[model samples]
Target: MQSTATSIKAYLEEIPEERKIAFTKLRETILENIPKGFVEQMSYGMIGYVVPHSIYPDGYHCEPKLPLPFMGIASQKNFIALYHMGIYANPELLNWFVTEYPKHSTQKLDMGKSCIRFKKMNQIPFELIAALVQKMSVQEWIICYESAFKK
Candidate 1:
């Protein structure tokens, strides 16, 4: 998720009316399942979930000025996107998701390396998304990220 919304509220407000409901529902699902110590804020011009600098002093490796980004949700021109860094870093998790997404719905899964793009509201798998989010903790994500830094 990347864009110029100064705040999450601003980010939400900028979403087109057609996307707000889906984004809002996904936002609620994310908020409900996010691990402790992760905070929601505007990042890269979108609504991002991050480990704050206060929790992890080093911040983002590529941009230490920013927090450690875990996930993000953005409404693109063609679809709504969910960026899951945890899945991107963990191949097993990605494989599991790719295998299981179809079980949640019949719609085709459209995804990028770390982005799950929903072309329709019904294409969003709320329970599956919630389950995926719940699988990672802040500590787990930090450890995974740190290990990546070593290589």
Candidate 2:
């Protein structure tokens, strides 16, 4: 499949008809809550958001390379994946998620560095997810994301 960088508007347009509504709504909510300088794009065959290095310069290990992706969203084979930096990155928020979300379950989620997989959208506690996304800073997210994947 052909893939390229795109905006959220473009990414939403490309989602298959059956999944468009739900995914678009989710994308909107994320955009509404995430911090300024966060961007949406298609990466790894999914809709993803990134906090570019220009926005979080102190957090970058190298300039003009490896700008971090603090959060991401993906439509997978069976379910939609909301890859938050919170899963393994922020223990406090992750603990809350584990306890608060009704049908959510998490194991060793390490896809491109610490992604939590959710089978059903409703199973997520939207308020908490938004809160976590908003509360965690880009540097915090980078720390958590990298720590999770450390070898």
The best candidate in terms of lDDT: 1
- Please provide, for model 1 over 1-151, each residue's C-alpha lDDT reduced to its tens digit, 9 standing for 90 to 100: 3667787877788899988888899999999999899999888877899999999988999988999999998998889999999888988889999998989978988888899999998678999999999989999999988886533
CA error at residue 102 for candidate 1, angstroms: 0.8
- Each model's backbone clash number: 3, 0
The pairs that clash in candidate 2 are none
TM-score of every candidate relative to the true structure: 0.95, 0.69
lDDT of each: 0.89, 0.62
Query: Could you tell me which residue pairs clash in candidate 1?
Result: 3-44, 3-45, 4-45
Q: Tell me model 1's lDDT, rounded to 2 decimals.
A: 0.89
Off by over 4 Å in 1: none
* lDDT accuracy of residue 50 in candidate 2: 73
Q: Report the lDDT of model 1 for residue 150.
A: 30
